[model samples]
Target: MTNPSTLPDFDHPPGTDLWVFAYGSLMWNPGFPFVEKREGLLRGYHRGFCIYSHQHRGTPERPGAVLGLDRGGACRGMVFRVEAAAVPDVLRYLWQREMAYRVYIPRRLRVRTDQGDVRALTFTADPAHSQYCGRLGLDGTASLIRQGVGQSGRNVDYLSSLIDHLAELGIEDQGLRELAARI
Candidate 1:
């Protein structure tokens, strides 16, 4: 796993645009400015409860499960187009917010959308990280989410918010839906 600070800063040629793929909280709260957004499809990675949050959603005593883009299948998410001038600031914020613990790998991946294909900055799951929870079953996952709380508030709120946003996008995540129902 690479520390976000250790990674070189993101760079783009002048006039080149920046794009970001939002599969989780980012969809609801991007925390940055973007020129446009569209529904997008990313292949080879799907959202799953693969990370145990030790800061935002739960504590070390009883970790909460958070969504990560694990390998396989495909993910339907939002792609945000950012102006070139804002790339540096946006990348800095995203690095601090999503890469604080190096639980995710910062990558530029291709996403297909109604607007066409776009190369977007995306954070992918780092299975090697200590926080990785692997493939915990739904019931076990739900149980943890039910009881977990951290600086960000209740884990159930996180799950429910994601479910609501996915519903608004007309995207169905059966596992998450079932888990949300149980919660």
Candidate 2:
């Protein structure tokens, strides 16, 4: 469990648009409204199944894997630009959805898009967090995905959903595909 005080605060003035990067479930189902969205590439971090999901996709006893933006490499994902007025509601929703375990630390990083560069808010795994698994071997990851079920449903379904969404975005992740096939 993470202390609420540890969560990062999003304090932005009114009338300032905010950009958010979505690499996992948010890629498919962003509950918040946004004015614009674009495919973005974030360097210095890669999306990997490096966190043990003990709430949404599994229990503590049988944890499933969830995607996290870990150090190194790069990630291709969707970037959403929310109008300033909508930022508050979006932050509230994201906090409830992604900050539960505090496994992810909210961050503002630069993302490259066709329109140019923008600083976007994103989540990266807290390597020190108890749920952080760093990088797990493919087989071990597959086993967890095969057995996990939680509030959001089957862990395998989550993985499948991510894979499907990636494909739809014209993003090819061989590592994720291999992990999915390994099971």
Candidate 3:
């Protein structure tokens, strides 16, 4: 993967807004300011517990799993509208937070929203990355979550929060729900 530092800055023209696609933690804690938000759908990708987190959620010795936009299916998420002037700072922050080890590939993905279809900045799982754990069975996933704890908090907390947020949105993720129950 290319260095995130070398990626283009997410700058918007004077009158344009920066739309961001949030499929994971960003849905609950964006950290940056956004003017508007709406339920959105991103096609050609589905949220999966595919990344082996060795920092924020666990250690290298016993990595925790985190969500990633894996290819196939569709993902129902939130799209945030960021002010143009804040794009630079927000992009910087996102790079630092999400690209600690370049486990994701930054891209402009088409998101379907009430406002219409628009391209938004999205971070997708890098399947070739060392941290990519790919597909895991519910029991295995739960086992990892049960043993994971990192700088941020427990892995179960992360999985539970995502499941809870999806429930609040009326979106069902059966696999995750099953795993959550096992944990």
Candidate 4:
């Protein structure tokens, strides 16, 4: 494994030391070649159902909320250390994958890892552009999580995987738990 700190400086030409934050699908599939992955934390930001689905993950006609890093609490995810030479190609791929929703706005974030904290680029919800499912209560959210269908796949599977992943990490989400129980 390459030491992220030792990689050639990307600040000049190649743009080395590129770090990416993976919250949802990216956690399981980054779709990029990375040198290292570490369990990391983002402070002052927590995952929320803030983004409305369009085409990327779900159909625009029947949209749902995907995870996004919103202000408050903390977010636990993975940090990917990518090669500088691969930044452009990787970024392009991400754009293509994420363009459908138009809910995410890429930004630089601070990631805390066992090695150390690093500033990395990550995508977050665009409040003005994203769909806030605040009206959806526990039952409604659980029902949506259990039965909604999307382009990516079934909403149940998506929620299941997220719940399972978080459970494996010893993180409990009451909303997710209720959804799982309903299913």
lDDT (0-100) at residue 95 of candidate 1? 83
Off by over 4 Å in 2: 1-14
lDDT of 1 by residue, 1-183 (tens): 333335644344546778999999798789999999999999999888889987778999988889899888899999999997887788788888888788887878899999799988888888888888756777778888988899999999988888888898788888687788787
Local distance difference test, each candidate: 0.84, 0.86, 0.83, 0.69
Model 2 TM-score is: 0.89
Please, what are the lDDT tens digits per residue for candidate 2 over residues 15-66?
7999999998798799999999999999999888889988778898999888
Best model number under TM-score? 2
- Give TM-scores for every candidate, taking all chains together and pairing residue i with residue i: 0.88, 0.89, 0.87, 0.77
Model 2 lDDT vs. the true structure? 0.86
Q: Which is the better candidate, 2 or 4, if ranked by lDDT?
A: 2
Predicted structure 4: lDDT: 0.69
Order of candidate numbers by lDDT, starting with the best = 2, 1, 3, 4
Q: Regarding TM-score, does 1 or 3 come out ahead?
A: 1
For model 3, where is the 10-residue window of minimal lDDT? 2-11
- How much is 174 displaced in model 4, in angstroms? 5.5
* Collision pairs in model 2: none
Superposed by TM-score, candidate 3 places the C-alpha of residue 46 at a distance from the truth, in angstroms, of: 1.0
- Model 4, 71-164: lDDT tens digits are 6788888899888888777766776676444566667778999999988777776667636563465576665555466778876677778878
